[model samples]
Target: MGRAPNTPYAASRYSAGGDGPVQQTAFIGQAATRRRLLGGALMAGGALAVPGLVRGQVLGTPSLVPMRLSPDQLVDMKCCLRPLRAAGPNLGTESVGGKLVVHNYGHGGSGWSLSWGSAEVAVGKALASLPRSVAVVGCGIIGLTSAVVAQRYGLDVTIYARDQIARTRSFRASGSYTPGSRIALVEPAGPQFPDLWEQMARHSWRMFRTMLGLPGEPVRFGDSYAVSDAPIERRTWPADPAITESFATAGLPRQNSEFAHLDSRIADIVPQAVPLPPGENPFGMPYATRSSQMHFNFPAYAAILLDEFFGRGGKFVNRVFHRPGELADLPEDVVIHATGYAARDFWGDRTVIPVRGQTGWLVPQPGVNYSLRYRNVSALSKGDGIVIMNNNPDLGDMLGVGDSMELPNRAPIEEAMATLAAIFARSAGAAA
Candidate 1:
């Protein structure tokens, strides 16, 4: 992976040798050397440090909650392929055998995060046809949201998909608001994409904010911490042309630099991460940052969305389309093509790249409400379950890019659990 370009809040700004305050604890004897050795060992092993050795508890700082991260606690695992396109998502209108088809798929990992806003775009195009009814080809988040938005426009809508929302790839998402995650490659997407992306992201953010306090807590905000033994590096966009050009032959998805970091365009609307001083850092890692993250509890959120759709007279047809010609058979003249990764085959779109992602779920904990990222492992405690994912930056954006295997692998999940176990074990040692 290439070196990431720095930003204002990059590691240099908050590192120990940077502008941040330095630790002033006195080291008077050999005991201090032993403590340093122990800290080095824990850091090398990807473990947290003892609280007493770091600093006394900081006021208002919450203690880290332990999670049952063993393989035995794993209830289920799911894998899905994110539809990635080098030029970003296909959000244009086209004529399909005399039928007006609006494209709304290929958002990559940002499907869930950008659904509402993208739906607004696709539905607006569909409305221009002045059709009495419309059909959505898939029941994933994108398709479902498009149907709901169409219903809001007083257009009779029906979804035609082989499976419902629960079985679709969107259900396996990490559920965080990550609008810029694997969205598009920098050179291919061109200059105009950032402004269009900002429009979608800001609209989606506002729509999500409307669901914050709804019944069943479909959407809510929680603190998420990114902790590390070394300074945290934040990647910026407009990577080197040589590096961006290598992505085509590398046979892997574009790395962080190659992807457009459109989230920064809406930075003012989104919560900014703040560096955690030693006292406020609960993970005991040498460096850490915290930011408010919005999460979607899919199980509850899906139910609310489906109920609202059904109540508004929206219908669903359990059908599969083998090719674009099959879409012409539908009763509606206007169709929102939201088949997601299936578009790679059905629509003969070779640009739809498959980026595989998997998540392991553990039974929900009672009071574990926050999220954490240590090393390459991430744990999110949502209302449905605890989502454990391997987001290794060492692999860059190519972590699971170009892979289409949907089978769940336990080895990765078990390895991630071991990492979490080590962190919690050291946390317990500190509490003792």
Candidate 2:
């Protein structure tokens, strides 16, 4: 076969040099030399240091993670969140007020982190009751993930959704590694929920780690989330026992974010986090902080995972249920509720607000590896791709610290041009 069309994604010649003339290719006159030192960008399994790059590649495999590796799996997307279209008429089996109800919804962001842990808790109730048939509502990240977990527990799960699995908010998301406001104190809190939140975070983080071991999918790289000024205190908790116990083991300091604007329940988990020196910050926000994160390509990862679920004896039903009575017809004993933003209407959960985020990605700028986000708006370069992280809107959230609901009408090409132009303008301005 002739070589495939390069399209516009062909690597830019100027990406290698800071602000130099463009070369005809990704490699340069000195590229042969640099190639020996910097062959590629970093992935989960293999990595090497080319002296200048901290998280990029080296000449050979340096202590590979012993898992399959495929850098080609990385794919850039240009899409928008197809928000739920309608007033869902409660196709719930259990009662909201009193009908064997177990409601798990309203994860504005951080749905991935809270997915497995939340499903674990939701399924625990159904398992205790010994239901033979279970019904799962919504096929967003929460629903699909919950169904997978329920199936793992040997429950026959029927996933019901109005839209196709890959067309929801889950797909539209620029899946960053940070956990946005999935859990909060909007509900009256006791010590109980705080413990559960901590437990859920740990479990979700571990699940993500396991996923990183897989090959040819979106899950890799250590990121440093630069959080600016924000309030980290005054959140409520839940009422769960096992969750509480597992949380105490976290060894996190209480009043940690209280005395300061920073908290550290996960500082021990991520290996790379330290205060940046005065000149280390990229955008120069008021305060610069760094915490390792995982920027993801949601479509690739979800496609692989969903295929695995369906292939492994899992069942999914595509129907937009209007009443809770419709769920009773499924062939299972236990049910898990994993609907995310859809819960806004399905369960009358108004908390599932849609916070829109706009990101501009140019053709791969491989050398800019470090993810730099001080506000919700950020600029970072992937090996051969790029994305701007989104946020779940909340009070006290810093500038560019929250995703918008503006529909992200910007196209990738437009975004890429704008970003590159901005960089070019800044450089030109500095020279003058």
Candidate 3:
């Protein structure tokens, strides 16, 4: 009982009585091994009855696999991990000089999507500061862009973050087309936030438009298409409570609406924003509208933005600021909090939930000019001509979102590949 279990072997063999079935089993195994060596098919004991696809050095693997987005499009969560909660107190309160503390963080998955618009809102308040020095917390898109706007105003600005510029989540983003109204306006009041919405969007658009042809930087102009599966009667944002509470911008034509609802606002701004002909929409999209999402090549864009900031005599300090009282140490008069989701802990403001949105990208579709989407599903072939996304709307916030939202549901990437594979599959005449 204390020894190894032996089935095909006899006790007599071990007792030195005679040769036994154990030898026969070993002999059979040897024979099978020899046969496998010669036949190029190997058997593992009695477990397997047939060879598997991976068992041999096969030829010609299919270019794509189902539910797998552009294999070329990969995201590493390690580069984009934000602590689920702040370990200490919110560090962005108190007056930097004589100005008020304007908090602007908690943008979860929509950082890239709403960067320009959100930054405009934050910067609008910052500009009102009239402080000679402005301090921006966190080093992601919002902070960087806010700092840029501050610089444009000729204010001496400083950036503080636990990490550096390119190493932040903004760099790892799958930045695609902008669905602007993604931000949740937390106002207990009624339809009074539209004016600020209009102001923010228009400014961000103008700001982004101004950067259209720079020599490869953060702000870019690239054609983006929104192909839909159905007619978009996008729900309108009745009103933004925050806009009302913050800016008193009520009833000025700003609403939380879908893309089709506000196509006119961005028509002239986006290069290819136009209605798609009925024949081009396969997902049964009742109407199609195209726009060039403010293309942000994180690598080049974020680098250039930060580079320009630093080059322009901006000061950046590398320190983990966990409490607002800690800001007193820095010699600045104003602080613009661009801490992103970390504001949850820093400010103790739970109003900001990590609205887990995701985007999937393809390798690059050079000549592909149109952005297409059916339902929330979308596609782009530039620098990877596909982008798919899944947000917390269905699944709720991503606690450990890190960067790769493509993990459990494989949301964005799967949709991207299936879409491309489907289109090409049709072009190649493959069955759905």
Candidate 4:
């Protein structure tokens, strides 16, 4: 018989008849050789199916950006209340002590994300009065953006606030483009609100694009990974009795109250999330997904907005308004009331609910540029610092609903650091 070609898949040929130890030894050797070839072929096929595994080993896990996760790394902690209104942001004009007050506050957690768009609405209304000048009530992101928008229309703008941008609650936010984050209760906001939300989201998205390549990367995109041990499924609102009762007791939105999710409306403009294959998931978790998110670097972003406002002949007045009537005392007949959560008490608007949010800042790690979420905790490595926050998917927006505590809590951040530490440790062990 002729010998077969020396290929992994080729069949081996043996003599038609064989006897004694010499023939048996030859047969055994051929069987062993065939087994080796078959095993090699299976391994080669596996390598082709999962190139990421081979590349991961060679490239040292490109997806797993190293982070120094520890409580000791926490340099600062900030707590702020997101002003959530049941009927969405107050964008309508109202007569306040004879002054045409255009309400632009109560954006909840979507203030930064919807600032420019909301500003367009507020400023447009303010301009209709044919006022030569305008006054913004707050110095937060919404107020700052609105003032800048007013300036673009050639309206001399003056910001009257007790606190500047740095001291305002907006400065403490986990600055990200979360356009629909607890913006409003679906039923209370009505059908028209979503359209308004889309308008604002699209406008703000376009405005953010303009600031992308600016100095200090005030607005930039980064990859975010959501890692989990369980298989990723469609997230649903929690129906747990305890959670519902707590929300009810706190006078917050119930579990059944759906929050407006308007992100899908602008999906074309925003980046979509994609599931990560097993071989590509570097988080050491069973399931993972990645998406790009826009982040606002507070110091740089605030500075640029402030610079543009002042460069356009705008002014800031260090004044505190104890009542809505005080707005009429301002020189400008048209005013934009962008007091954010403060509008709840100052404007006597009970619809504005306070949702407490806290973030811990860590020393900046230039090498780590990605963001991650694992075990109810989220971490984003920004140019200024690494921001870590407690964001449980199960709780949804209800995580901080009805909590007005502005004092920073160190315990939650410490717990989040520990969770991150375990994640990184397991990843390191897997790599080793």
Candidates 1 and 2, the one with greater lDDT: 1
lDDT (Cα, tens digit) per residue for candidate 1, span 21-66: 2333432235445467557846664223433222222112453445
Full-model lDDT for every candidate: 0.81, 0.48, 0.49, 0.81
The sequence of per-residue lDDT tens digits that candidate 2 reaches over residues 1-432 is 553343222223221232322333342344344445444533322123211112211111111010111223224444432221111111133544233556666554456656677777777776777765567777877778777777787777777787655777676655665453423321222445556656776787788778774665456664453535552233433233443422124321121121111124655675556554433433223344555666565666777668866876777778876655555665544456556655556656543334344454444543344555433345454433566434322333221212334444444434444443343333233222
Candidate number with greatest lDDT? 4
User: For model 3, how does the per-residue alpha-carbon lDDT over 1-432 read when each residue is reduced to its tens digit?
Assistant: 453333232211111112211211222224445456434422331211221111111100111111223455554222243222111112233464354677666544445655667666666676775778888887888788778778887888889888876776665556543533333333322244344444555666666666667665445545454534455443333434554422123311133321112334555654555565643322222455555555655666676777879887888888797776677776776778877666667766654433333455554433333344544455543333344543323212222332434233454556555654554333223111
lDDT tens digits, residue span 261-346, model 4: 77789889888878988656766677888889899999999999999999999999999988898887888899999999999899
Instruction: Select the stronger candidate by lDDT from 3 and 4.
Output: 4
Q: Which candidate do you rate higher for TM-score, 2 or 3?
A: 2
Task: List per-candidate RMSD values in Å.
Answer: 11.6, 12.0, 18.7, 13.0
Q: Rank the candidates by lDDT, best first.
A: 4, 1, 3, 2
Locate the minimum summed-lDDT window of 10 residues in model 3: 51-60
TM-score, one value per model: 0.84, 0.62, 0.61, 0.84
Ranking by TM-score: 4, 1, 2, 3
TM-score of 4: 0.84
